[model samples]
Target: MCCYVGCVSETAIESIRRSTRVMLLFTELTAVLPIFFLLQERRPWAVLGLLMAGVVAIIVIRVRGTLLRLRGLWEPYSYARVYGLVAAAMGIAVLAAVTGSQTGVFTAILVGITASEFFVARPLGVASRHVGIVVALQSAAFWIVVVSTGHGDMVGPTLIGTIIMTSGLAYSVGLTYRWWEGVLKLEQARRDAAELATTRERLRLAEDLHDILGHALEVVSLKSELAVRLTDPEKSKAEMIEVQRLARNALRDVRALAHGNRRTDFGTELTGARGLLDSAGIACDFDADPTALTTSERDLFGRVLREAMTNALRHADPRSCTVSLAVTPDQATLRIVNDGVAPLQRDGEGSGLAGLARRVEASGGSFTARAVEPASFEVIASLPR
Candidate 1:
């Protein structure tokens, strides 16, 4: 079977993941920069708390990477640690704000923004709502303290900047996953189309010795049986003579099939139909005695059977089907009766029948497809004998 080969390369997907991870972590560590501006304004312990928040951030990143590698897709293990550091940063912001320092307000906003990003790469699912509420409360408290200390001018710009930064980090990875899923679906559809083309080619080249000899051999068996049961010796000898003629004809057809002359064979089509139905858990019954047909007629009717079988597999969930051949001295008829036809769909359902009907009519034959009952459909083709 053929398969599609072109797809988004593994190198391209890995590159996207690495670039987004680096950018997100870089933003998270930028919180400690405000401590530089506050070197002389705050006590040493207050400065140490801001420095410890940065260290906790680096440790949180290492843990996230470890969890992603070990479990591939698991909940974050650093929940308690991430928020604990956010709360500690907010506490320090309150103390620094009492001195009416403007730099201390910026430090609180940066630390809150940094702590929120650790959960952005892979969100906490439903727990993320709680994350937003906790951050919103911390941000409101920081603004309130700055306003009370007569440092209200820094409120608007600082608040707006942090919100924009937080929103960008949150949506980046989710957008990446959406891109990944859409590419995979298109790749799978390409592979299915390729395999279908290959299967049609194989079916066209499937002529073999067994299929070439099938009809003639059945005729020989019937003649031999009749000869064995006859009481008149002369009649028995005549039947054996006819049996020898069929055996010779079978040998001639086998040689022709080997030379790539015959395009279709009834025995080959019959075998393929049986295998398809059996694999799908459908019970199929083929008639034991088939009407004798000319070589060209056999080829034509074999194609009809193949087309009918293909439609059945694709459109219906059938439980049982019967394939039979009938003769009326003037015409030879092939009929397929199948159960489990879907009742409501008329558009494009059994749509190939229209083209197949044209094929049958061009060869001085008639074709029809009709519903026999609520859950049954029948197809019939007749050619002049």
Candidate 2:
């Protein structure tokens, strides 16, 4: 198993299946070697026929059980059928003991013990332990029968050594199967987690699109309707111009959202915020300097500015809004202040603001949003230089 770990390019599950199949083939050949040697000794045709039949049956059953288990299709009936074949092989070994053929008895015992390897294919820990105990018991029974029935010529430490070797091989193979199962399960869990994270990101993007485009479209609709009701051509023209601007902004935002490129430049956002505030009939005061900030700092502060502007437009009845940016030797700061603070209608912050705060903190910064005065709402974000 260790030798094959780096020999394949398949996935974990496929690798496990390939390795288990190789192990089964190796064990099958070794189990049949003893019978092949006994035939070289000119054993009786009847004895060879019976021993060959039992060996073939045991191999077929083990192969079938191993395939089913690897495909995760093993059931109670399959398990029972394999164990029954093992019993028949053990019966053959008892017959060999009665017939005074030491080689046949040893081969039968080896095949029966190898059959227990199929039981270890089950995924259950308790079942593997039980199968191991049963194999040990069967080996002990074989040794006792071989010694008691005057077949003691080969019943010294050599007999005990063979039993130990077979039992150890079976146990090691079972443990390796269990270890592979655990690795495959862990790989499956990681894949599931990755898929879940992708799903959540998709949902988040949907929500962001709704929040951005929905607000812009609603404002466009309201302003266009107002322009329609106006009797003066000049006022109607002005309102239509504002509506056009809003439409273009919405389209740009949609493109950015679709491409997963939402990062904003601080200077661009400040200019856009001033335009939006003026178009909405609110006085705008903008103050920012980008010469001292790094690209990451600008991007972070830009997102904060955008979110604050969005919240102010949607949730406040402000007469004026102010955006100010300042950079010192150690840090850079952004503050958005608006008059006419609305009453708090929710107990918690919105996801947009929460996400902004996380971004700010992730870049070694700080964010705060609160009503700084009875009529003024303020948002402050600070980042290290």
Candidate 3:
């Protein structure tokens, strides 16, 4: 049924649910039987035995399918009928207690307690509070009747049994309900976690496509513009051919990415970034040692550099940019700073920076991008070594 999670078996959940329901119902059905002798004692007061039997009958009917809603066993599911029946049973028990002056009403009080605990309390959570109240009422009934009607000899056993049954009922009912509720909560959380993972992966892929296509198009623009200005036919044709090759490569990369087999190569991206910047007449200062970074860190920093360089070229008039890498004993940090960082870039109006932050934090790292004073923007990412 996948009731708990993807890997959990339907049989396991069914077994747990069935066993708990059976135990709870079994205890509930036998709740009044423990004090049978007390109820049998001198029904001469006013046919209290008949009333006791009536209470038991009503509760049995009410409890027949007390968990009907849980199993979806009912065709047109409803609790109105069960609620009315239990109410009637509680009323009868209450009436018997009020009128049975000399007879002990402890059994009647137990009837009320079980009805409230099982039928009302388990579903609505309101009747559970009455467990203690009715138990106290049962004790009062025992003491008052025992002294006047002479159940004094049966005092020790009756009191002991009442104490055991009430305590056990309260504890067992509550424990099972809370355990069931916890299982449901854990199931919901598992589903939410899976959905969140899938959504984040989609966002990551979108960011990758943005980095890939954004830079490719930017370089194509630059090469096409340079080709327009060239007077030599051969050089202009060569630049146009280079632009075509770059477009084809970008299209191939998009296909590879869609196939899910594409991996980031830091060296290839860095070389491409240098060419794009040179073509744009932007001088870049890059100080990096590739050996210090792991494969994943290299991929992450490569994306960082690509996004930063693309933003510099696309959004600003820039003559200079700097890309720096620093590795310490405990951490590796990458920083990309450019002088022509536009004012609009200060407050990120796009998902690129946000996606980078999500990726870095998911990998137990940190990322930040903010515009510095004097038209400069800085992007920094750090990972634990």
Candidate 4:
């Protein structure tokens, strides 16, 4: 029996069925060969009949190939049923051969094969118990009938012992099958969880792209309109330059969004922040050490850095902004502070710091963004391993 159950692919099931058919045919031929040779002298006609039946059963078992070429009509259980029927017929024929003399041997074979079929064709859960009960009853009745047969060739105690053994074997096979079914269900659940994670990540990337590009485009549009109304050529040129810068920033962010690869270079983000703060007339200082960080940590740090830079350039209006990164044995830390940042503005509705705090908390980290002094605002994230 194949240990793999739940997620058995079609190709694998077909292969098992083919091998089973060949094995069943060989077993059936071997079992009947003794009967054919033993009864040749006493009952030539019966010998010929049993041989013909065995040949037919072998043919039926091998007919799976022709059935496979058809449509939905052909299935594993379909062939399994054919094999079971052949086995039952063989048992009945064996009983007919020695009915007046001994019926215990043939009865055992008949009941065992029929009960085994339920486990082979049906799923493990409900059918396991059903087959167990049926086999138990059949085994009990078989023993009782054998006692009534009064055949001296088969000892009375031996028949009872055989029935007991048959019952134990049948119940064991059913329980083993149930365990195999559970493994299949577990495999399916793991596959589902992986697919769900992939879908959620894609949605997150899509939302990030929308936010970044939408803001950059809005700023560019506003600058373009403002440049048109300006009387001074120098101011108009400055506005146009800012508009061009926004466009390029938007393009870079869009490319990152398209790739959907959540890897970040801290050094690159530091350089980009310097250019943005310098253009906005805010002195920005960044400090960090170069080291390899895990992909998840890098992405988290990048998002925090980007949000801090955006807030300083867009809302804080501070003369100077400082960003720092510290790494320790147990944790990685990021701190951003800007002087003359109003307390009310730090906690304002327009600030996206609250959402960033939530993200950090969900990732088993801590985030704090608030006004420490009358005019100074600070945002800090501490991520622990």
| lDDT over C-alpha atoms for residue 384 of model 3 | 90
Q: Which pairs clash in model 4?
A: 6-184
Between candidates 1 and 2, the one scoring higher on TM-score is: 2
On a 0 to 100 scale, what is the lDDT of residue 76 in model 1?
42
Top model number, lDDT? 2
Ranking by TM-score: 3, 2, 4, 1
Tell how far residue 129 is off in model 3, in angstroms. 6.5
Give the TM-score of each candidate: 0.42, 0.70, 0.74, 0.55
Off by over 4 Å in 3: 1-130, 145-149, 228-233, 255-259, 342-349
Encode model 3's per-residue lDDT on 1-385: one tens digit a residue. Answer: 3334656544665676677667656656655652464455554545565666666676565466456624534232134653454355445544554455333345444444343434232443544554555556555555555555555776666656555555455556545555555455544556676788799678878988987898789878988999999999998998899899899988988899899987776667778878778877889998887777889988888888888877777777888888888999999999988887666655563577777788889889999888887788888999997
lDDT of 3: 0.67
Q: Report the lDDT tens digits of candidate 4 across residue range 120-189.
A: 4356664556555655554455444555565445555645654554444444433333333343444455
Better of 1 and 3 by TM-score: 3
Clashing pairs in 3: none
Model 1, 1-385: lDDT tens digits are: 1233335445654565465545545544455455564564655765557555664564465446533632334234465765665566566556555553655554554444435535533445643564566558656876777677676887777566544443443334324333333344444455566576677445433423433444455446656777898899997998788778668766776676667675665666777577556644689998723338767667767767766776665566689989998867798888987888888745342335665676678789999887777677788889997
Model 1: residues >4 Å from true position, as ranges? 1-42, 46-71, 74-102, 108-135, 157-385
Worst lDDT run of 10 residues, candidate 3, spans: 69-78
Candidate RMSDs in order? 12.5, 5.5, 5.9, 8.0
lDDT of 2 at 179: 57
The parts of candidate 4 lying over 4 Å away from their true place are: 1-104, 113-136, 152-194, 207-215, 218-232, 256-263, 274-299, 308-324, 337-379
